[model samples]
Target: MTPQFGHFRAESGAGPLRAPMARWMIALVVLLFFSAPALARTAPDSFAELAERLLPSVVNISTTQTAEGQSGIEVPVVPPGSPFEDFFKEFFERNQPRQRQRRATSLGSGFVIDARGYVITNNHVIQDADEISVILQDESRIEAKVIGRDPKTDIAVLKVEPSDKLKPVRFGDSDVARVGDWVVAIGNPFGFGGSVTAGIISARGRDINAGPYDDFLQTDAAINRGNSGGPIFNLQGEVIGIATAIFSPSGGSIGIGFAIPANSARPVIEQLIKHGAVRRGWLGVRIQSVTDEIADTLGLKGVSGALVASVIDNGPAKKADIRAGDVILEFDGKPIDQMRKLPRIVAETEVGKAVDVKVWRGNKPVTVKVTVAALEETEEVAAATTRAPNETPKASIPGVGLAVAALNDRLRSDYGLDEDAKGLVVTGIDAGGPAAEQGIKPGDLIVEVSQEPVTTPDQMAAKVTAARESGKKSILLLIEGDAGLRFVALRLAAN
Candidate 1:
């Protein structure tokens, strides 16, 4: 009996099928032999060479702070003749004088950026430390002094006089670093120095809400607590980022880590070294993100750019005639891709330099020249200013389903509004109306409609009608509330 051949296999004890089976096996072996090399090229053969060269430049940072201890806990109140009162008082007396000053120490990692002993680390690492020290790869301890620190970027520069010249690493362009590029990080994790980890760039342009300029590069590298301020290097052994934070629930490496890109940190580091502080340019305007609703209301093609909520008085933007309701599309020729990018770009710009700002106004692009100003140390305070009384009469705006009243003495008293409050106070709203659907409550005061001041209910109604007649599907309203001012878009009711 002869055994039959089935899909690349043959029955046992069938000598006739041996020749075909052998040929199939040979073909499979040949395919694997040719494809193995291609598969092997996906990952690096070894990170040892890169790690060895970069380890010397990495240093361990140790800080010591003298913290004052509490004397004792306060005794709880007890009823008269309570038996536990005596015991509690005795416990407090025994522990009162035992409190004393103690030294607290922390460990982190950093890298040498210059041969002259200038090092870069996180600002939080050595903050408020009474004594700071750096431990080198050769196990030599050197005292370091804080050169400058920027809390905004969480970067700090340190200076140390070493016995021998130090090895330094140069920065690489992080902008060119793509996702999935191989990266290496050398740091002291949990006080264990000279540890190295390798991974790929997991993501870029991540906003972790750590700071204002939060363009962080996310990596799956095993970054731990003591890795803060350490350098994240590319395959070329160039510093591309500084390890700043990590996202973990167990207080250990879950592989998600964040680093400040070299491009964003380099300028701040340079400014710190030269001026001992970072000088950020100021474009004094309050900005919010443009949502789909706002885009449709403003007749924009897409949801992009930063919507100017309010312009600071006498600021660079106000002086340049940048008003509220303007959508800033570009600054200094760079497109404002999102609301957050504008702040970072403006801060990096040179103070006192004139730059062209393109804004979307009246459904068209308008270019305005604004001389950037130095940001003041103090933040702008929104002081309540009294508005002059207007005798405008009240009216009902049924198109948007709003019943508003003028800001008069009687209305202010009824609404419990401050005497300084001005605008058309919303007294009633229909449940199914667009205004009510957008969270416009009965107490909200409509200060501006389509960026024009509306003191009376009639003015607000007229503005809404005009916006609808002009083919706008919705209108932008600046509403004032107990919290602050905010912009809202209310859709127009169909005729």
Candidate 2:
């Protein structure tokens, strides 16, 4: 129906306007029903109230470093009394002194975590600084000393003696912060101290290859060079993230910034304060992501958890009898939804505490109690071993795209294999075949077929035949190469 609302505002002829006004009200009500929810969120009218109070807690950090002198260019000895002799001598004398010593400075951001003078910032900010200075909002400059640093996560803590009571900010639960929630970032972007910018959490659980433990919270805030180590605060004026890096092509804010989540950073910060260094919990195993093909081949219900590539010798996993091919489904009662989640969970676990580890082994679930141990800075995974060979293959197996040979003394010497290395080494690969497509080389060792250890070519063939018979269409293999051991899934095809 065509409703005419022009007569609704006709005050002089109220009797005629009454019906139209009622119809206009009805149309408005109808339009509201098909619109956004009544409680839809909107931009806060202003962030000034939150910014004003948080400014004091955020700090500006300046670091000074004296770089080593550059090598002095050889000043040719000009002929005595030559016209160029004096100019050459003076130039050489002037540049030599300046080149011998130089001072460099850098600026970044941090926040007060404790009113007793404990501050938090990025390790790269004060990494090589000979002197660190923390600048407050009131223009007061104080010297800061490094308390501890963890390069893996790029987090650092500093201590300063403040003359008065310092304003400190508390941490909020970062795990609860969603992608669309509004956030405020206060930092010293490009040396502009006490600067505040607002944006929403762009993403979370981002792995930008910055470090091993890279569960960074992505944001679109104006994070630049000096914004490193600043706090990403939620609307409640609590710290939820610590700004660390940006993904800008032109070295300016293109809205892509990354921050260390408060939930991850808080524990490390506390450990750094309690001890001079971080003592991470170590679960000795080399793990890789569980692929869908691998899950299907191993009869797993779903593609999840970390697939153990190799178990370290005499370590926590070894002591608990966790095998090399087991898929760790849970650790300390927390479900490992992804492979990367295990490292962080294990690191946060208490040292020497016994925890239940659930793994997928033998096509079923197996639980073992493992005692956590302190992580050594120089920890290395020991070599994986295979059983003794039974018989060598006479020819290439046409169903599989790779040919395996039993390890021999001559072959071991040719490939520089250790004395105890016992496995079916890949002797040949057909061109354009499954193994070749997967980048398997000739010297690589086949350690396991699916989850069982393969000693001879016949054993490897039997496992492949069983997988094909079971309608898996592919087989999982544990290959040991120069880089280390890894699991590879190959489709069933002719060599």
Candidate 3:
């Protein structure tokens, strides 16, 4: 059948035209296969629609600070006959004013967090602002009144009286936001109104040393100078973070931006909205991380807890028998991952709630119940009793060559120390001794050695000898000064 069709079709003149038409049909099919998806992928969709939808809630914040000159500006006393007198007179006389007023103005971005004219922004945005004003996208200006400010977390709330209900944004749970989720940032970057940039959540839990409660969500959005107080929104248009900072060498955004997580800000913002301030729970204890050496000295196999340096007398921890040197492993059933985490957890706990505290003491874990106390601005309480008053002084040891003295009333006054600073003061330092080489100087107090309290030079010396006998090359010392206490590691010398 195929042989008969070839012989019959070639007999007609239409065969030649059909061959050229077949080549054109093949080329059309190949072009359509490649160019269809390419045209679909490169089409431009303007972000103006999204900007128009979000610009109503975005705002610009402007702050003003009046700086003053120092008092008593004096002209230089130059001899009348001196050659440089005329030059000095010409230079200084022009600016001879005793005082000058300087003014500072800054701009940042923020968003409406409520419809009743309540707003949220970074505390630093309007911090120290003599006057604060918010500029809306519609060119409406409104004076903002500060409701509250939390410097610890760098958050602030403000209120404005608008003629009508303003658009407000709801917060999204930052904890549920996954990495790589699309995010959009609406801010006034470089004084431009309602600038929008789209990117993904680059990372989370960035510290960045911005504040004490620094749990930031890192994003690649275009955050900049004026973006400081803006809102970073998720794809669903919920505020997940407040744009607060950026990392760039040229003082601009280079796609590395940080925002305070909504999870950490939600409670603070709610409290500020309701009570005009944040009321955190406080556990009055100075804590430090337990190092490997500290764990070994305390007869533990590893370091994984916070060491209680001192519990405030009559405070929550002290009332609960949480003693110094105890390792706090868990608090309120939440495991304390690090020393810094403990402060945040304790502060976030509800005040007056009895919480279970798991601590390690003497190679054992003990769970104690502690009632959380309200964290006040001025929490002045009696210091813990570390030693008995006027106890018999122990004789100083001579072998290790550390000169020590008992804690006395005169010594305490001389050292400018608190009455409760229970330790032997190092009075002298050997010229080339290991302690001196380790920067231990006279008048410095030795509080602890190898996790044991040292009240005299003999105790310190004995502890060092014991540690060395156990094949340890370094000794940990809890050193204290007029300011406070710190831990130090010193290399021990072989006798």
Candidate 4:
């Protein structure tokens, strides 16, 4: 028989006056939860000592320009024929300035990259300035001169003669920086002198549509309008990236900031310092993504590379025996992971270096050694081959949207078919038919069906008839349009 108990369970002979274990359990649970985060917090380091060691390197950039100011100008119209108007008119007549404008001022941030007082900042920060000054952390301001500026990349270099040797910061390798690495940003945000914010690298190789070379290092560190051209430091306090832009609708810190990766900007900086401009190597080839259908058509095992749609004639690729149908698997020993990477690598490579290119052509792998050349505008190539003349239409199927015809030159030229094109033209598209729904319009060249090439009307009819006989609902047609080739999945209706 069970004994009746109220709101409690106990073993036989258990003690009734027991200390509560729930409070201890709750305390232990709370301790366990707070331990990890509390241990992860960084100890606060005094910036006064740190700034004393590094402040000599940091510089406050002030720029002034003679722009037409709306304020502090005497009114041009007479104020109720007051005597002051006559005084203003006489003053203006005496000073009759060639350029009627007042001076404007802007502030920004920069750092000395060289002991000789060579500093770096964004081009937009100091653009159109009549006067520029570099204020050191010691409250000593030196007049600066613009050495060079690159508007495309928004980088500028300035020179200031310091009375003493300036501490210079070296750029770190940004390519080795991974996500989750510790980073810090130092700049004059909102004109506040030498502010510092710390965070981890949020992402890498970010493209914010800023420039052609948009390999930005995304970070969560606070970056504002005046933060442009400031140094983004790694854990070693080396400059790894330049804080350039942020993506915040409110123009405040939403934790999304973009910095130009040192891997991309370092070379350009060197070029700018040496020659005052950047000269990127170009290949002059148009490329497209390697889709699944394209990979299958090319007999590639995986879709992991770029597809050469059309090689520019007399360009680097064409001069190096790179053909139209070649699928580039690797360039310069680096795997072509995506189509966008090709342009960046090609632009960074030396123009005269010999590059080894691996390509897939006709179900076989081939290696081509190509000497890179300078890019230029391409010229059109004349027709080298012609299509066979088309015979008249033999039959018009009742349900299908197509009128069949033999491959012909007249139809080929009219369709602007490719040199190797040999496809039966789709003469008509049935209204509300499967072909029409799949965007297979009239005069489209039907190149292949079910991965088999079709040239004549009888061949196309046989393929369709076989597909229907095989109990297939969808017929895949490789249609060639004015742009290029693409696959269309069409659902077959009941015959």
Best by TM-score: 2
**Model 1, runs deviating above 4 Å:** 1-42, 72-98, 380-396, 399-401, 413-420, 429-433, 466-471, 493-495
Q: Write out the backbone clash pairs for model 1.
A: none
Per-residue alpha-carbon lDDT of candidate 3 for residues 390-489, written as tens digits (9 for 90 to 100): 2234344344445678778766665555777778876666666666765676567888877688776666777878878888766777777543465555
Q: Give candidate 1's error at residue 275 in angstroms.
A: 1.2
- Which TM-score value belongs to model 2? 0.85
Tens digits of per-residue lDDT for model 4, 30-131:
677769774664543643454445556767788999876444455488777898888878888786655558788888888888998899888888999999
lDDT of 1 at 431: 88
Candidates 2 and 4: which is better by lDDT? 2
TM-score of 1: 0.82
TM-scores for every candidate against the unseen true structure: 0.82, 0.85, 0.73, 0.67
Q: Candidates' lDDT values, in order?
A: 0.89, 0.89, 0.80, 0.75
Q: Between candidates 1 and 3, which one is better according to lDDT?
A: 1
Task: Show the colliding residue pairs in model 3.
Answer: none
Question: Could you tally the backbone clashes for each prediction?
Answer: 0, 0, 0, 2
Better of 3 and 4 by TM-score: 3
Runs of candidate 3 exceeding 4 Å displacement: 1-53, 64-104, 178-181, 379-421, 427-441, 468-477, 487-495
Instruction: Show the colliding residue pairs in model 4.
Output: 389-408, 390-408
